[model samples]
Every structure is written in C-alpha cells, then in structure tokens.
Target chain A: MPHKVIRMERTRDHSSARRPVMVAIAGDSAAGKTTLTKGIAAALGASRVTTICVDDYHRYDRQERKGLPFTALHPRCNYVEIMEQHLQLLATGQPILKPVYDHDTGQLTRPELVEPREFVIVEGLLPLYSKLTRACFDIAVYLDPPERIRREWKVSRDVRKRGYTVDQVLAELERREPESAQFIRPQRAHADIVVRFAPAEGHDDTSNSPLSVELMLRPTVRHTGLRGLLAEIGQRTVQLRLIRDEDGIPVDALHVHGYAPREESRMVQKAIWSRLGLGDGDPVATLGDVGNGRRSESLAITQLVVLDHLLRAT
Target chain B: MPHKVIRMERTRDHSSARRPVMVAIAGDSAAGKTTLTKGIAAALGASRVTTICVDDYHRYDRQERKGLPFTALHPRCNYVEIMEQHLQLLATGQPILKPVYDHDTGQLTRPELVEPREFVIVEGLLPLYSKLTRACFDIAVYLDPPERIRREWKVSRDVRKRGYTVDQVLAELERREPESAQFIRPQRAHADIVVRFAPAEGHDDTSNSPLSVELMLRPTVRHTGLRGLLAEIGQRTVQLRLIRDEDGIPVDALHVHGYAPREESRMVQKAIWSRLGLGDGDPVATLGDVGNGRRSESLAITQLVVLDHLLRAT
Candidate 1:
C-alpha cells in the first residue's frame, strides 16, 4: 500500500501547485461507466474534461489472457504499479504515454500521448481497485447496476458491437464473476457515490420502460444544499433521504426516478444548476443528454452534482 | 363553510354502511387531470373505479359564462351546490344524476346516470374548493404543473380538440387567471399530494424530453414504509425528505423521477404494492402506462401509495 501523504502531495501540480480536479468512475464491464463519463465530458465541454480508460494497462492481450491462470479482473492481470504512477502524474497536471487496449480485436494497440485537462475522469474496471489509485481522484463513483440488468446489457452490447454470441457472452460473464466479486465490487466501499440503475418493483417490462436511478451519496465529500433543493422541488423527480449503506454508515441517498416526466426533472435540474453557480447557462442542454436522443435529467444533474465538488476543489 | 363533523358523518352509508373509497384529483384545464385519473382507474381496474369529471356540474354553458360577471373558473360559474350534494351521495356509495358540459362545443349537454363503483375518482377544477366536497374524498391530489407548462398544455389541447385558435386560448387563459388564482391554486393547499409536471431545465424542447413528476406527500396522511423502502432499494427512484409546504408545515415530500428506467421504477412499485397488499398481479402493465404506450413508474407508484392509505382507512 502506498503512503497517504505521498498520494496526497501528488494531487498538487509540481510547477504551479494548482492541480486539475480528478474524478474516478469505476464499474464492472458494461455497467455504464463510459456512458456516465461521456455525459459528464459533454456537460463540462470536451476540452475541459479529459477521459482515460485505465483498462489500457492490461498486461496481456485477450488471446494471452485466455491461457493465463487468472482473469483480467485480478490485480496480476494488469500493470498496477505503472497505473498508479500514471495516475499520480495526471493528478499533478503532468502528461504520460498511456497504453491502449482494443476491445474489438482484443489486443494491445498503440500507446497514445495523454495530457490532463482541467477535469480528468478515470474510468475502467479497476480505477478504484487500490487505495493508491483511489487517492488520485477528488471524487470517485462506482456504477453498480443490478447484476441481472447488467448481464442483459452486456449480452446486447457484445452481440451488437463485438460480434459475440449470447452463449459466448454468458460464458465470459461466468468467467469474470469471481474476479469481479474479489476486485470490482469491493471498490464500491471506497467510492464517494455508488450509482445503480435498476427496474423499480412491478415494472418487469424492462424492455420498454426506462431504468430508475439510485445514488448512494457516501460521506466522503461535503454535499451542500442538496437537502434544501430536494425540499423546494417538492416532487418525486428527485428525492433525498438519510439511509444506512451496506457498511451501515449513515448516508444521504438520493433517488432520481427514470420514468419521471420532463416537467418534474427540470425543477431538480434547475436547483442543482443554480447551486453549482455554473450561472444561468444551459446545463440541461449541454449535460442533460444521455444519447439515443433521450435526455436524462437525473444523469445531467448527477454530473453537475459531481462537478460541484471538482469546482469547489479548484 | 360546511361543518366538518356533519360531512364526516355523511361519508358512511346510512343503510349497509359500506362506502366506496373516493379520490379527488383537481387541477386547472389541461393540467393532466384526466391522464392521471385514467392511469389510476386502469391500475385499480376501470370496472372497479368510476371516474367523474366534476366540471360536468357547470351551472351555465360556455356561452352563458361569457355573458356572466366571471369566467368558468369562478365558483359561481359552476353548480357548486349540486356538486357538493352529488359528492356526498357518491361518498356514501349512492347514485346521482350527473350534468354534462361538453368542452368541444362549449354547451350544456344532456344529463346522465352515475353509480359509484368500489372506488370513485372525482377530478376537475374545483373538486377541493369547498370543505364539504373535500370531506367526500379519501385522498385528494392536485395536479400543479408549472404555470408555463400548464399554459403550453392548455394552448395545444384547446387548439387541437376544441377548435380554438392559439390566440383565443391564450385570451381565455388570461381571462381565467384571476379566478384560477383565487379558486384553483388554493385547492392545492388542501391536497394530500400535489403533483407537478414540468420540463427539466435546459431541455427546452418539451416535445423531445419526457416530462418529470414531483409528488408532495403531505403529512395529513401517514405514509408508512415509503422511507424504509427507499432506504432498502438504495436507489434514487423513490426519495423521501422533510420539506416545508406553502403553509410552512414540515412535511415528507417524495419525488419520483420521470426519466427513471423501468427497472428502478419496478422496485419501488413492488415495495408499495406489497405494502398495500395489492397482491402479485401486474399493476405496472395496467396502471403504469402514461399514454401513447408509455409507462410512468412514478405515476404507478404514486397511485399505489395513495391506494395504501385508502385501504388502511377501510
């Protein structure tokens, strides 16, 4: 384990001592990590936010991993030391030659020159797997959608984009489950916010209805004005309540209804947008979109909420 | 002012004393009163639920109101006495001769027979305007969408369905504004739940984004298990928080996000369903729909939550 003081010191820039705010989004495969990061990037403007998939550190290609004793989820499957070093560099507003892993061909591709921007989002399966890496982010999020829903998403995505059959995807999921439990799920304990998109009760027709979102807001960072905002909106589009997390720690849980009408969502959005002092600019237009021409008021608001912490840090 | 004790005593039947659970949904024109009533009726089974639009109690025709001192929104513009009597009758599970007002032709049409079902839903502009009428309801809901959103809805609806020009509709809205303020908006204070629908901020294109819903759960009714359910699900779909109402009463406000996916909505629905002992049947398939083949998980859950209180009273 790395010393906390060392990682803490690295968060400040070496030259100017004014560090870029770093955010980490960790999740299992197909758990909506990139989707969330993408919306945040778009919301903050692409130039101001830089996104890096830390899975680029995979030590073996897909073909090599197949013959290895352990799965890619294990710490030994990647260059953990190098990943930690690069994270420290990025935290200090330095640049690095980051490795690349291509999912289509399942191979280690070309390395790329990566520079830290005003805001850096590190997303992948293991971004928060270790304390050293976790310390790199000012705000860390874990995407923990229900296992069944995640499986469905994985199968659909693999079939559409990776040319994989349902059977192959299922088999891969089984292979990954053990390591996921050992490595990925534990990272949630370290996250400032754990977000899950799942079906609400009696809504078994997940095929048509949108998934509702639950955000377990851990006490790692100070979340100001959210309680006041939830009170004023007085609608179910966004809710705030005190709850005990899995660790039995008292936390504020905010649930954003996915099937909420646009009208209900806007009130909460306005509350968050105003609180962030992002001014009267259009946060919903720029940040509210979640692709497929569908705009997620909650997603946009969540991004802004996360941005609130980063802005405060700056 | 009607005596509360007298009206309360009249709620039970005189003979067998088996009263139908009465629900009142009040809102301004085109504020989604019918849409909400339809979903609730569908959820509880249309045969089991009788819906009556109290706007049918208009004493004068639309043409007659034009020559009167006030607009249709005025209590004097409606047959409030007859409405109060019929509501009392319905609360005791009796039948009544209901008058009809045709919005399409703006005429006083033929009267019809109405028998109270197991559940009766009374929705209109002034269902909660009078103390006598308010006592007839087991649950009262006010559709309090944002003024601008309601105005947009009114313009579109009147232009398409009533064959009125946009300018004409706007003029009528302007004409009705004072009475709306005096009579309609105040009814919200008496409601157990004030539901608002609005376009999320930044999503100016209401046509493209789904409307969000916020539910103000007043303390007048004891909402059991909702907070526990929110904590257990650990999602943002259903959130409960302490809020101060317009009258400065501290209340528990539950917000149901409109853009929530079916998965998240289903979880909350199941919790509320089970708590209400609604059995294992599919309320989401029937009551969850918002129209045009869309299902609102929050709307469905809200219906069930209200049903819980009614059942408890029974």
Candidate 2:
C-alpha cells in the first residue's frame, strides 16, 4: 500500500478523550465519491456527521483560470494548504469559515460556517493527495468507478444539469484525460479501502439489481475489524486468490463478477460473520438496510459488521 | 462608453458563413450575465443560438490555482489570448473545441466541441476585458445591478444555491467587493446598453405596492426607434431615468427595480411595440401579460425591439 496503515487497537475506556474522527472519500470527478460518502454518512446518521466537499476551496473562477500553466486538478491551482488547515481544524472539533463557488455562473460565492461533529467526511478529488491532508482523516476510502462509467455520468450531467450539449461534454472528457490520469488516479494507491460500483457485465441486472460492489481490503488488515460483516458479505465477496501486477507486493483484490446469486451471497456473508463471532446473538438484525436500492442485502451485511465492531470496541 | 460599441447597419443573417458573431455579456460575477443571456438566446430560439460560459475555460483544477497572485477576476490569471483566439473562431460560425470546467466540483473537466449558429453568447466576468475578444462581439451589453441589491442577491444566492450559510456568504462578499468595483463594474461603460434592475421606488400617482419594476437604459436611446411608441412613452419615460450618486454617476447602476400596476407595465410594452410597427398584432399579442413579478418583462421588451429591427432590416 502506498499509504502506511496504522492498526487501530481497541482503546481502554479511560482513553476516551473525545478524539476527532475524520473520514476522507477521494476520487476523480464523477467517480461516485459523493454517493459512497452519502451511504456511509446516512448509516452513521446526520447528527454524528458533517461533510466538506474540497471543491469549495478552489482558487479561480472557471473562466479566469482557463489555459493557465496549471489546471484545477493540479495542487498548485488551489489553496490546498488552507484546506489542510481547515481539515485539521474540523478534526480537532473546531469550526471553519468555508468558501462557496457557484457552479452554474462560475463565481466564488459567499462562504459558509462549518462546525465539527462526531464525524467529518471530506469528499473531493484531492482529499487524499497530500500527506498533510491524509493525516487528517481517521479513515480514508477511494471510489474507483470505471472511466467509461464516469464518462457516461459526466456527459449526462453536463448536458442535462449544466446546460452543455453532448459534443461539449465529450470535448471536456478528452481534455481532462491527461491530468486525471496523472493527478487523480494516483490517489487510489493511498486509499485504505477502494470501493467501485458498476453494472453487472453479461448479466441480466438492472442498475439496482443485485450487482456486487467490490470492496478491496488491504492485505495489512485481514481482520478489517469487520470480519462479521465480511462473513455476512458472503457470495458478494470474490476472494481473488491474491495476485499483484508485477508488484512483488501482496494483493487481496476481490471480484464477485457482479450480479451474483443472492442465496450464494447470503451464505458467504454468514461465513464471514461467523468468523467475527458476533453474527447470531447480537442485535445485528436490528440494523436497517443501508445499500442503494432494494437490492440491499449487502448493506445489511456491512451494517452488521460495522455495528458489531463499533459496539464491541466501545 | 467604456467599451467601443459596435452596431451593424443591418441585421446579420444566420450563416455557416465566415466570421462568427461573438456576443459578449460582461459583468461582475452574479451580475445577471447568464440570466440576461439565457433570455436573449431563448428569445432568438436555440436553433439559432449556441452559448459558451467563459467559466468553462478555467486552466486549473480546484486545488492548484489559489493564492498565486491575481484574483480570477483579473486578466493575467487566465489565458486571455487563447480565449480571444477561440472567440475569433466561434464568431465566424465555425466549430471550435472548447474546454469544460465543473463549477460544483471546481475541476477542469473534458473538452467539448461547440458548433456555431446564428449567434453565440460568450458570458463571464471579464469576457469583455481583453481587446482581442472585444473585436469578436457585434453587440455588447453589461448588467450592473445596484451595489446594495447585488450584495443582497449574492448573499441569498450563495446561501441557497452554493451550499453556503449567511455569515460565510457575507465574508466572501466583503472579499469580492474590491475586485467587483475595479474589474467588473467599470466594464459597463463599454457596453451599448447598460442594464440596471431594482425595485421601483415611490413616485407621484404610483401606488406603494412592491411589484413595480423599473429598467434604467443607459445611453438611453436618443430616439425611441419606433416613433409611435416613443410618443406614448414620452412623459412616462421617466422609467428609464436612473438616479445618480453624489459623483454624478448612476447611484445604483444597472438596477432592476419593481413597479406595481401591471397595466402600466403592459402599456410600456404596448407602446414599445407600437413604435416598432408590430402594433398589437400577432407579434405583440404573442407577448404575455408581464407584471412586477415577472422580472424578465423589461428585458423581453428590449429584445422584442431589437429582434423586430433585425428581422425587418434583414
């Protein structure tokens, strides 16, 4: 892993001195960072959460910054240090005066006040880019939607919501390709967890269908603190026999191949849960479904695992 | 006038022909450039229009461009020359590849192709700043809403649309004030028509109702082109009168004000059309009953006059 993963050992009750719990969701534009964060935040409940999209700290208005030596994806184009400072402040349970940029008109709009809560979810492209920023997050995840999927989402959004035509959107996709590859994609290596959502290929699965969401856990965390949830994830998990790409590194890549049978997935979930030893007797059943669509069997599994660990550790 | 006004002796016909007609709508951010241009384009019909927001051309992503030196409102922060060249291509009815930037995410997105039509609305803070770009537009207008009104509008918009709270919006407003005065407001003098919208204040024989809207047309036409309409609008023409400040400058420049008595506003419309020789005929009737509530009434009136003149002259 490009990032050093520190094991979070169970803290003694006397050590509970109100530490800031920050979560970072980093990804390229249209990479589903917002959606993934939304799920996590909703499950965590709004009272315990607050979100800060890094886009708020942009340096220039859309028009003025064009054709400059640098593009927005570059760290030099924005107030990254200030953002890091703000992240630190939030993690320390302090309030921040955040900037607002208008998207439709491309203006640096008024600012907003952000008071920290139990969790601060920072979601944006460069959230995990710097060591300083990475240090702010208690947990970090990267959304790795396929380029094709991102492009589709971008084209539709620009045309429908942003008043751009299809041709205009396509042009942008091409122009940003180089920077995206160089600046954005590299952030994934630093992620503690990488979550990607895609339609089931060669399967009769609608978007909300029982499509398997692949969550790659670093080999460093075999326990993942969510063994119960992993066991519950069951058939949704595709343990890819651990292979690395010319990297002498160990890889624990998972690929359920998507849209797998629900029954089989249920069984897999149970096995992972059994290992955690909290599947049956606990109130894990009380956890509501938290995944997208009615196809949320996977969500129940994740919830059980997370809640179990959270409760036991507390 | 700050900008050299260019007017065609006759209406320029739509063409795949050479020399794209660049229409520039320059003003401070949130000075109603986009709102005004959208009305103009829709009035002309999308088939004859293509719009390019100058904001789409930013050179940096959200994080890279901050605290460098100049504000995004300044010319140096942008690739002004390149944008001017692009404008040259666009004005002559040619397809040009344009860059895209997502305002919400503050990222320079992919590039897209823009096909020219009869007209293109190139709008932004400094769309009119560069001399080369100035050469591209056949018609130029500036929206200079009143300072107090602008501040309020800005605060409200940032809070509602841009994910900002009241205090943050106020602070940003304070920060942007200097740039707005120096870079944006001055551009108004360069326009053929400087538009001001504000709420209509009390006058003799006018009710205390809140709906009255007043449009102050700077360089108010020497002669209301439509003779008959001019006569009817003769005395009541004080609607175009803008109160000047102590410096003998428009106290509240480009203020879009509201006036009550819907009938009076309709009369203004009727009088305008009567001058154009369109009369209460189909073209005149096609205009819906406008009131203090419909902010676009005055703008639509101006557009109708221009379009009538264009179609008739051609």
Which numbered prediction scores highest in DockQ against the true structure? 2
Q: Determine the TM-score of chain B of model 1.
A: 0.89
lDDT of 1 at A14: 44
- The lDDT for every candidate, in the order shown, is 0.76, 0.58
TM-score of each: 0.47, 0.42
Fnat for model 2 comes to: 0.00
Tell me the tens digit of each residue's lDDT in model 2 across A31-57.
Answer: 766655654555556787788899777
Q: Report model 2's TM-score to 2 decimal places.
A: 0.42
* lDDT (Cα, tens digit) per residue for candidate 1, span A1-314: 12222432343234653357888999999998877888677767777888999988887889989899898888999877567756766776666556678889988754555778888899998998766687677888999999998999899889989999999999999999999999999999999988888775568665556667888888888876666767678467877889999899989998878778877777677767676666567776777555578766667767766776667666
Which candidate has the highest lDDT of all? 1
Interface RMSD of each: 36.3, 27.1
Segments in model 2 whose C-alpha atoms lie over 4 Å from true places: A1-17, A67-69, A199-211, A220-233, A236-240, A245-248, A263-314, B1-314
Clashes of each: 55, 68
